[model samples]
Target: MRYLIVILALVMMAAPVYAVDPSEILKDPVLEKRARAISKGLRCVVCQNQSIDDSDAQLARDLRVLVRERLVAGDSDQAVVDYVVSRYGDFVLLRPPVKGATLVLWFGPVVIALIGIIGLVLFFRRQKKYAAEINRDIG
Candidate 1:
């Protein structure tokens, strides 16, 4: 009975699939594959860190529909991304272009690392100075 209950629990825990409707598939499988690849690179605005293809948020669904619509309309993958970028700006892209306002976003970790190094140097210098003073007094 315990084994049966555990099996039932495991079955219940399976995620309910929200797959795109079968009729929505494009006649060209290649185009659909490209569309999916592009969608996976777009972040869902309503889900901070989840890709649009992975998120179930309303905005993700809307973006998925938009991607499919663009694919059916014969837009290139980049063109579809450019359209969304024009609408929502660079944040929608998983990898935003490194330019202008994004310079800091691209370089922030390096800047932080330099700052940490400088702080450590200064701290060590202060400690060494205090140690020298203590030794001088002891002598």
Candidate 2:
């Protein structure tokens, strides 16, 4: 029983995670593949941390439909993505372009890391100075 439970858990963990419903799938395999790829890169506004493809939010579903509609209407993959970005801003993309206001989004972590390193160096230097003072007083 324990082995069966462990196997079940492993299988569940290995399963691919997606929320694509049957009705959302396109008829053309090529289009469907492209749509899926695009969806995987779209951020769900309602669930800010989840991609539209993996989100079950109504907004994600709507975005998925919109993508399909654009594709069917002869929009290129990039055009469909651009359309969504235009309507919702760069935040709609999981990997937003490193331009404009999003330049902060791309570089904020690096800036933060540098700040942390500087702070640590200053803190250690202060601690060492205090230690030296204490040792001189003891001597």
Candidate 3:
């Protein structure tokens, strides 16, 4: 019984888990592959942090179906992505384009870090000046 349980566990762990349902798969292997590729690059709006391909959310399922439908309608991979982005905005893309609108998303962290560093430097410099004055007065 323990060996059987171990084997089952191993099999489950080895299997690739995807949120995509069999019904969502395209009949054309080529189109299915494209749909999967596009799905991986899209963010799940409901989950926010998970890729649509990995999210089990109902909204993710809808997006996956939409992608397959677009591919079946003969939309190119880029066109399908564009259509989704148009409806959902750039936030749907995991790696949103570095454009004027999204520049803040790309660079906001670095800018914040710079501000923190500058503030720290100013704080330390003021502390050092205050300490020097104290020492002079004590001497």
Best by lDDT: 3
| Model 1 residue-pair collision total | 0
Q: Each candidate's TM vs. the true structure?
A: 0.63, 0.68, 0.67
lDDT of 3 by residue, 1-139 (tens): 9999999999988968778999888889988999999999999999999999999999999999999998898889999999989989998999889999989988999999999999999999999999999999999
RMSD (CA, angstroms), candidate 3: 4.4
Candidate 3 or 2, higher lDDT: 3
Q: Which lDDT tens digits does candidate 2 get at residues 1-139?
A: 9999999999989968579889889999999999999999999999999998999999899999999989989999999999999889888888878887787888999999999999999999999999999999999
Residue 95's lDDT in candidate 1? 88
Once superposed on the true structure, which residue ranges of model 1 sit more than 4 Å away at CA?
A: 1-21, 115-139
Q: What is the full ranking by lDDT, best candidate first? A: 3, 2, 1
Error of 1 at 11 (Å): 12
The lDDT for every candidate, in the order shown, is 0.85, 0.92, 0.93
Pairs with steric clashes in candidate 2 = none
Note the clash tally of each candidate. 0, 0, 0
Per-residue lDDT tens digits of candidate 1, residues 19-84? Answer: 454555567899878877988899889876988877878778778888989988988888999999
lDDT (Cα, 0-100) at 50 in candidate 3: 93
Task: Pick the winner on TM-score between candidates 1 and 3.
Answer: 3
